[model samples]
Target chain A: MSGPAVVFDKVSLELGGTRILDNVSFRIESGALHCIVGANGGGKTSLIRSLLGQMPHSGQIRLEGESLGPVGYVPQVLDFDRNVPMTVRDVMALLTQRKPAFLGSSREHRAGVDAALKRMGVLEKELRPFGGLSGGERQRVLFAQALEPAPSLLILDEPCANIDEPGARIVEDVVLELNAKGVTVVWINHDWDQVRKLAHSVTGINRKVMFHGVPSEVLTWAEPKAMVS
Target chain B: MNTIYESIRLTLQGLAANGTLPQAFTYQFVINALLCTLLIGPLLGALGTMIVVKRMAFFSQAVGNAALTGVAIGILLGESYTSPYISMFSFCILFGIALKYTQYRTNLSNDSLIGVFLSISLAFGASLLLYVSAKINTHVMESVLFGSILAVDYTDMNILLVVTLIASLVVLPLYNQMLLASLNPSLAHARGIRVRLLEYVFVVLVTIVTVACLKIIGAVLVEALLLIPAAAARNISRTLGGFVAGSVIIATLSCILGVLMPMQLGLPVPTGGAIVLVAALVFVVTTVMRTTLSRFRATGV
Candidate 1:
């Protein structure tokens, strides 16, 4: 319960006969804001998937320190036929409520859902169909879902992608607040400016861990040309 | 079975006593057919919502098509051509699982996979049907393909009843998990929901329903019953509850209307075709209503 929050030792992944990540190794400290930066198709999502146990990988991924209780994941934008009618409350109920959603949500969980939505500034849209919400609004709702029960490690994949300026600010604020409350955050980020401002530590990954250190030092060490190309 | 028939007869007689139904409706065959529809309609409506949400329309269609092959195999195995429940259920369930497993393992899109399975099943069924044509009466094949509600015997009714009960029990508790898996499988998996297992269960359930209702709805039009009601409901619903409820209502209405209209009008149309046509009409109306409402809202009228 006192060691690093996550330890990735010699992690290698080969997907569909292509090497996605090779010999990647890193350790994320407990209660620290860690940002992962990599170019497109550079195994950023693959690395997260490996950590989430969604993909097969070789080597060790140990979630140490305090039992690693209840990791929250805010996945990328949902890719589905949005025409399937489902409201935000329905989605939340699918995740949080134990009973069947078709039977209707229990009153006990409604207040909790409302509180979470309010925190994400989407309380009014709680009853709106998820397909009808704007992309930014959907992102906020997803964030709200992840925040429920307060995960020990919150893993977000491109939390700001396709979000408006105000939505981005709201995300930043919520992330900072979670980090301040001792929630370990592993963010996959694209904006270097935000990484510099928010990340306690930054790791440059391009199929492997190229650099890992404090944000300032890692920023100087990770050259864009070397990492991406 | 006799008691069931007697009770249905009495019910129809009582309705006739109150001048609710004509004397023609009290016949045993008519009563049996109506009871079968009552059992199958709401279940189809409920399951169809998930079928549409998960984009498994073609998959269900493939299952339906596979039922023909199942029947053909049953005939080849020397089972009664008229009631081939064993081979039909086994073959369709296996076929559905294989389709699902192949889709999971390969990169083929769902529709393409279903198309492949559909073609293969149809080819197999056609050849077997031709081979068995000399041994069995052709009218049996016609009934399997296009449905004959008059053939909904006591055994078929009991199977439908048991299937409806089992399907309700299994699907009701797992409904949310299945919906979650359909909406976002990775998230559901992260939450410890067995996404793959749930998917297989859903596929098998669709197979069961398709096979059970084949005698009344036919192999060719069963998927239509599974798809059109949900599609129409989706056109008007804003929430999952409303979508499911609307689908049930539309499906039940379509089933009743499809059956009674043909009987009342003395039309010689296949019951399955009649049901599908009714569902299609509902879909068209709902689509038009949705478009009109959206347009009116946009124009502030």
Candidate 2:
């Protein structure tokens, strides 16, 4: 039930003659809720992209696991056209199955898609056009898709970027619940309070590994006032 | 395949003799044209959904324009006018790949790239048409620019049939992945789908279908057949299944009526223009209906 420990060895990435990430190295303990904290344009997404093999970077990123398990990813932003005519259920089928979406989502065989939506509180919106959903609702749908099949390693980039507060809380709960179940959660979190309160460890990146430590040790520089209170 | 076409033609002839169908169906060319529409309709309709959703309308239209240059180049290269398969196939495929490759290599937007490609192809087709007009008859030029129902034969029916089958087999099963790839290449790549490879496969599919369709839809108006049906379907449908099914039905009907109406009314319209006009009519009707329904819903009427 446990997941793999990820290792980054001297990772460096340069895009269009500009260095994005330079010689960054760190290790994320398997089965821990590890949060990545960084400012805007700090290459957090790029690092995760490298881990998912989306970018060509000079690095030896290894997942140390007995059996390499499935990796689930929820992107930071999904630009869906307003009139493309796809339902949330249709999108789940699109993301999760190789079955043609034109065949429609089979309720009998796709209990999992419904279940994940229920977990994210978007089950009622399953039949609605994906584009019509509010910003927070769309984020919930993305989280639902990533959680199904109970991935061994989940990579979330700003999962709560534009969501409302209550919606953000629901997503945060899911991440914590998933981590407690022994899934490796590599989350790029913009909200510092959630990371400070819940993350087992934190890694700060500003084109490099600026800091990597437990939440207690990391918050001294991020917010000394929060640490005092 | 020819036996199948022959048998269908005979059956239609029997139906026409028995007064079950119009007398126009008695002609082998009418039967041939209808058969071509039968296959081309569903193929373009279904692929059009993907093309429309991917925002590849311009790219596909550019390919249709390229088909003109392909045809002219085929004629100048001494290829026959009836079925210039090789020159047309190679040129369109090459044009499609090069356009896709340049999109990846250059900083220019896809529309700008397609715009430039379309302009060059149109210019090439214009001059080539003039050059070949002296050698081939002006009548043949009309057929090439627009579609000619009379020129369709059993060979075209067979080629269209094969492409339709191949396209259906490839597209129907992997439709989800293809949709995802176009929507979000990074997500598709993360899900272990080869995005770049799928792009090429899609380009090739569009090329073959575009070339195969040149006989009936013609170069100028083929993109209309591809876009109109799918656009109409999207205007009303709210789910993927409905969208695809609606597009296929509208497209099939448009193709059938496009070919038959011109013949029955004794109009001298080209088959390509006829098809587009019919499809555009459907699009207009559906759009009005959708707007009215939405307004009614807004007022709780």
**How well is each residue in B268-294 modelled by candidate 2, as lDDT tens digits?**
987777888999999998888778888
DockQ per model, Cα = 0.50, 0.52
lDDT tens readout by residue for model 1, B127-237: 888988888886776766677776688888888888898899989888888888877776776666788899899889989988898887786667777888998988888
Docking class of 2: medium
Tens digits of lDDT, candidate 1, A13-108:
998899999999999999889999888898988888888877789999888885656677788787767777778888788777777776677787
Candidate 2 achieves a global lDDT of: 0.83
Model 2 Cα displacement at B160 (Å)? Answer: 0.9
**Residue A203 in candidate 2, Cα distance off native in Å:** 1.4
